[model samples]
Target: MKSKGFGKKALDLLFPPRCQGCGKLIDRDDGLCGACLAKYGDEQRESCPVCGRTARECSCGAAALGSSFIGNRRYCAMTFYNEYNADSERITEKLIFRLKRKNSSSLTDFFAREAAAEIMRLMQLSEERPEEWIITWPPRTPRAVLEYGYDQSEAVARRISYYTGIPWKKMLVRTGGREQKGLGAEEREANVSTLALLRRKEADRKRFILFDDVITTGATVREAADLLYGAGAEAVFPVCIAKTLLKEKTDDEGVFV
Candidate 1:
């Protein structure tokens, strides 16, 4: 009541900003504009040279299915982390925040559309028979899900179904283990720390592709593969929308799952 009107006016003026993805004006949302949806209409569709995964550049050397002694198959990524735009990266970062803080399941639609677009493209590129394949993502522990309200990764997997014409199996359960952070590549690469397990009645011979928005240490997928194989998935491989390059980076992050 003392001087509320002037301060409120000044605060509004100072906070006025445009959406990062598109130049549109908005009352609240940032990072992405309303029309900044990802379109793969002109993206490259060639298979990768080094690993047979799909990509224009063949920089991959990750272990293949038979080589892993576990991983079922390998596939291509629609984009490298390098291709991520500033606005998109911000949105991605926001998703991590929303998951970590708000823990809202509603954000799935916002994050999954971007991921789904990329996965749909991957399925489109495969020469394998076109039938519905099982879908999955790393599951969060019951404690984490309850603490955060929902599993963002699972929410992401659910969103992917509509675009990929696949079904997600709710066959995995988390053990509510410790989080992986500040872990090195070597340790991460050899991680035996898995926090999830498959349901008893779920089919073991089911074909499925695991999903993750990010794949930094490779440990997350590596650990998940063990549980999945044990569950009886005939084969299971990962399908990330973006990949990290081997080149020294400037830390300018980009679009994410």
Candidate 2:
């Protein structure tokens, strides 16, 4: 029998691995090359989206999140993202696009690790135990799931569960809807009818951490939280790999919905 290492070496020679961000050949098939990896997490938050203060100094309360549907709970994200920026300038956007186009365990795991740390920090500050919270995600549209053969958010949630030791459950379902990629804020808000509760009774007074790949207009999460609240969830704290930043809005203007 051939050694697995030998087989891998042969495969690499046959099909060179290219960086997902820049198409540069890399030593391994790890989604991104050294340069792209170094560039990751380098984008400064600049200021807290909830408050106008510098990110490192801001101490806004949960109610400042500006989402009445979440019971004034806080949301966490690893980085800020802007869909309008060219992927060349925003490697995170490229990673997100790649993840949506195809599932990559390494990529998803990377995102989950960061998100897990942030979630833990928030829970610790709030004196909430991990076991008290359930990990869940706003399921992707059925059409996207069928096209990609997986829900990227679900993949991230499962990995986060593994990192944080929190149990993950499928609590929401998306029947069918047009993809929200290019839709405007109002269009996205009006598109919430597609989502429905999957485990309605299971949500009773349960504290949930909703995970997702990226948060754009916040429409999807708002709708998801609404469903959970209606299902009797005690609270829903959303966590994501990236949060969309509105460049036109100043820090004092509140970037999130």
Candidate 3:
């Protein structure tokens, strides 16, 4: 244990930990600085009065779930995403951008910790056994994989499995399709239709925690959930790092208050 502590100190000296959000020096590794965490973390969370669920988990918005399949599935996210927000330095979006454009162990590790906690919440909410549930993510487009050299969702899912002792598998494949970013709701739905089951036999009678980086219009995840259902999945619970906030939640200034 002394040797381990010595090694950690040496490593810290060589490469001092910095906040993944703003590059501020920090005492810990693989996490955000306290200032950044306080400014952009769960302190900003809002809840729905009627459902007593966080903004991400609330289903009160009329346009929240664009897919019937998603409407029926249990889902939640770590935070809210509002692209139109005036704050250009929003750490949630910045972290997500870093997650896609680079291979940052700190960022992935941070997401994994959050994902593991959220997955456990979903498991408890659904009364499902942790050992019986499987972790899976929709494979990124071929173009994305080639450009980024990694799948962000899969990376987080694997890390979650490592931390939580749950099994992670590659269950769904994206058969060459247009990127979902910057697309309208209908367009996103059409693009997600390209997803197909990679292993139908493996999915039989299993419950899945569908992990993804973001949930917008609920198209991609919903389609993935439908494929899993068709393949005989007993239940599908969707979880993501961020969820697009409904218009009402976004103030006139385009900020999520």
Candidate 4:
């Protein structure tokens, strides 16, 4: 019989791998080339330790509000998508656009691995690593699924589960919601409150980590966490790959702005 390695080599020869970030030819099927990988590394390292904002911005307020609805709940994210910083914003937009539009599985896998590592690190810092933590994600609206042909958040969550050795299940169903883009914080919160319903059977799990792609006003995750808490989840930790920085309003004086 032919060896498995021989089959793999034949496939590689037929279809050489390309970098997920730039579509450049590469040796492997599952990651960016050195330059693209370095970009991610630099962003991760430069992001704020507290709220994941880039070095000059402070947006911990939004991060703080992530768990406001659920007392004592923790929230964490990988990096910031700051609109004020053109470069940071552009990179974030590109990453998300590629994931949602192209459905780049290798890119998704790369992000999932990073997120899983962060989740583990956070759990370790808390000193309460549960033996079996349930991994779940906020479901996209059915309309979005229809438009995108797949759910990006779910895709990332499943990959994270695979990387972390944790099981992932669909624990929430999005009933309805208008698109959250361009909405103010208050409107965003109200909109998401009616967006999701928990799956009772799955909700019985003790601990859950709910992840999403980007956290803007944090309304979506907050509402999702509330639903999970209501469904009897002992704890719900919100995780995301990128966070949108809360833009500060300032007057002409620029004092206390």
lDDT leader: 3
Misplaced by over 4 Å in model 1 are: 1-31, 34-61, 64-73, 76-107, 141-143, 176-193, 248-257
Off by over 4 Å in 4: 1-8, 47-59, 62-73, 83-89, 177-194, 249-257
Give candidate 4's whole-model lDDT: 0.69
Clashing pairs in 4: none
Residue pairs with colliding backbones in model 1 are: 54-76, 84-255, 204-232
Show the colliding residue pairs in model 3. none
lDDT comparison, 1 vs 3, better candidate = 3
What tens-digit string does per-residue lDDT give for candidate 2 at 154-174? 998998999999999999987
Q: How well does each candidate superpose onto the true structure, as a TM-score?
A: 0.58, 0.75, 0.78, 0.76
Task: Identify the superior model by lDDT, candidate 3 or candidate 4.
Answer: 3
Candidate 1, residue 11: the lDDT equals: 57
Expressed as tens digits, the lDDT of each residue in 1-257 for candidate 4 is 28776686687798787877667898887768877878776776675555445622333554343432122234666666664332334555567667777677787897898888877776676666546578888887775776788998999999999888778978888775567777899887776425565577567646888889877767777778878878778777777787764345433222111
Error of 3 at 170 (Å): 0.6
Q: 131-245, model 1: which lDDT tens digit per residue?
A: 5477887776555665667676777787777656678877566663343456687765654434566674474777667777655545677677777777676767676555544
- Backbone clash tally (model 3): 0
Better of 1 and 4 by TM-score: 4
Clashes of each: 3, 0, 0, 0
Residue 176 CA displacement from its true place in model 2, Å: 3.7
Error of 3 at 172 (Å): 1.2
User: TM-score of the candidate numbered 1?
Assistant: 0.58
